[model samples]
Target: MAAPHDVPSAAQLVAAVRDFLADDVLPAVEGRVRFHTRVAINVLGMVEREIELGPAQAAEHERRLAGLGVADDAELAAAVREGRFDDSALVEALRDAVGAKLEVANPGYLGDG
Candidate 1:
């Protein structure tokens, strides 16, 4: 059977390929081949997560930047340097942003999880 018309999206495709490598390829290989296959699987996993989480993360990031009165990271940094925003607010915003990134990059490192 094929994927439904709306099924197997970009994230799904990446996840399917990642699963293929992990389940079918990883165990079938050894040594350097195994190592590289593992890396490919890890990278594909990250890609899948990014596909699923990137849009929401981006929107949240943009909102954070807007709240800080900046267009982008560079502007945010400039604002920080100029002390244009509340220090506590800026720190909270940055920490929240980092946590959101860790959510996609690796939730385990986010501490609160």
Candidate 2:
């Protein structure tokens, strides 16, 4: 969907800052500052990915929750803890949800390499 705003949308702005920090500011920092800068860069990356994927992921999550007859993740967790559902389908659905989250959080972590 086209952003209902001008150029340099939220994701673009975040990407710009993240790139600036990584390519310029990061190299100049040391010790704790460098560590914190790295952390900030990671956070900005997550924010950018979230901006790109959050809506679709949220819709899919709601659909998956409905499929499992649960209103939300907390209820799903409760059902799982109580052994109310146990099946391959359930496992796959839960895995898919986790994978979607990983995509936003850190896609590299899911890489085969």
Candidate 3:
């Protein structure tokens, strides 16, 4: 379904551009231009996924941070820098942050975690 605005919501717009680059532009280009077009398409694909997943990921991130008793990443990092986190908390925080990033940057890179 279209958004309440009636047409081409942000994710839809991103997908349209990504499809255009991959389907139309990729087939017609060659060498360096093709490589760059492929990169652009991948970037747009990431944008579309981010549009869809970023909100939920952000909420989860905040929740995880709260569980660690911090407000945001800076606090968590500062604690880590000061050797505040125990081994388990340090590992968990790092894993959650990296996992959230992979969910946007490259889900394929993630393991069963």
**lDDT top scorer:** 2
Deviation in Å, model 3, residue 105 alpha carbon: 0.8
- TM-scores, one per candidate: 0.86, 0.90, 0.89
Ranking by TM-score: 2, 3, 1
Model 2 ranges with Cα > 4 A deviation: 1-4
Model 1 per-residue lDDT tens digits across residues 32-73: 999999989878878888888888899999998988888999
* Deviation in Å, model 3, residue 89 alpha carbon: 2.2
Model 3: per-residue lDDT, tens digit, 47-94? 888889898888988888998888998898898789877789779877
lDDT of each: 0.87, 0.93, 0.86
Clashing pairs in 1: none
Candidate 1 wrongly placed segments (more than 4 Å): 1-5
How many pairs collide in each candidate, listed in order? 0, 0, 0
TM-score of 3: 0.89
Q: Comparing candidate 1 with candidate 2, which one achieves the higher TM-score?
A: 2
Between candidates 2 and 3, which one is better according to TM-score? 2
Cα-based lDDT at residue 42, candidate 3: 80
> What is candidate 2's local distance difference test score?
0.93
Tens-place lDDT per residue, model 2, 1-113, is: 37688888889999999999999999999999999999999999999999999999999999998998999989998999888886886898888999999999999989893
